[model samples]
Target: MSLNWITLRVRDLEASLNFYHDILGLPIERRFESRGKQIVMLGTGAQPKLELIQTIDQTLKPECGVSVGFEVKSLDEAIEYLKSRGIPVLRGPITPNPHLRFFYILDPDGFEVQLAEHS
Candidate 1:
């Protein structure tokens, strides 16, 4: 079986939309708005998309049991861009065992997303 999309509950629709789209450069496939609620679809290229749904919970905090590790060509460049934007970068572009270089970032909702170079 193949996995489809991962959905996230975002605190602020506008900020989340700006972060995932403008900041991260993920393209918006589609969007729907109703009853003060919003659903945003994000994708890179033609790959599977991520669903960002606005949350009604004002106190919701992004948690970590599982985190998405995104593969990039260079972690250094990715982290630099985030740093330039003043985003909180939790860790660094270190070679863990010579097979990967990775780091973590705290998204707007406090969710941890990792950037890595893996093969």
Candidate 2:
């Protein structure tokens, strides 16, 4: 048995669409609305990828302690891009250890996405 996909319940589809696809640069492949809800697929070139599905609650706030970590070629580069796009960084890429460095940022939906670099 294997996991297939994880769906995040998003309050605002437009806001999440810009954050995941525009700010973070995830490639959006498809989008559609059904049963009064919107769904968008983001391809990661791998199975068990992420799908951001939109619901009706626009004021919903995500619960604490749920984090998503994504690694990039250069954490600095990502930081710069995010800053330019007006995304606020909540923490640092400061060296926590010799093998780990991460910075956390809150998306529009209050989801924590940790951008980290492992050397």
Candidate 3:
């Protein structure tokens, strides 16, 4: 079976949207309100989408040991883009081998995001 999507609980829907949709450049595929929660799915509709959910009655905190990863064509360009936006790299540019390089950064709600380049 193939993966469909991954969901993240966010404190502010607009902030999350700004990061994922505007900054990361994911296109919003679908968005709607459901049972007092706002949900948005962003992706190209070819691969698995990233889902963001926000609710008013609950305070959401990102959990440890979980992160979402995306592949980049150039690790240097990705790093420069993030730096231009004032987002600091939390860890890495680590190379496990000659064919791969990666790094981590925190999303708006402080969830780790990994950007990797594979050669």
Candidate 4:
């Protein structure tokens, strides 16, 4: 079976939308409400997408070990852009190899997000 979507229970819907859509440039595929939860799907028309769910209770503690990664055109450029927007890099521009580099940042709801570039 193929991966369809990864869901994140967020505390603030608007903040999450700003981070994913405005900051990261992910397009909002759709948004709707279900079972009293506001849900939003983001990314291109692809199988593996991001789903943000905002419930009435905004008590969410995101796991430190769980992080979602996205590929970037340039790691340095991404870092610069994030810095310009006042988003601090949580981790390094770690290079596992000569062709790959990545870094981590915390989302508005404290979820870790990794931005990487493969040269």
What overall lDDT, based on C-alpha atoms, would model 3 receive against the true structure? 0.91
- Per-candidate TM vs. native? 0.86, 0.85, 0.94, 0.94
Mark the 10 consecutive residues where model 3 has the least summed lDDT.
55-64
Ranking 1 against 4 by lDDT, winner:
4
- Candidate with top TM-score is 4
Candidate 2 lDDT for residue 88: 77
Query: Compared to the true structure, candidate 2 yields what TM-score?
Result: 0.85
Query: Model 1 scores what on Cα lDDT?
Result: 0.81
Off by over 4 Å in 3: 57-59
Instruction: Quote the positional error of residue 108 for candidate 2 in Å.
Output: 1.0
Residue-level lDDT of model 4, residues 1-119, one tens digit each, is 88999998888899999999999999999999998889999989755889999855666777747789999998999999999999999999999999999999999889999999998
Instruction: Mark the regions of model 4 whose C-alpha exceeds 4 Å error after superposition.
Output: none
Q: Itemize residue pairs with steric clashes in candidate 1.
A: none
lDDT of 1 at 102: 87
Model 4 lDDT, residue 106, Cα = 94
Candidate 2 residue lDDT tens string, 6-98? 678888888988888887788887888778778998766665656888877766667657777788778888889889888878978678789
**lDDT values for all models:** 0.81, 0.81, 0.91, 0.91
TM-score of 3: 0.94
Candidate 4 — worst ten consecutive residues by lDDT sum? 55-64
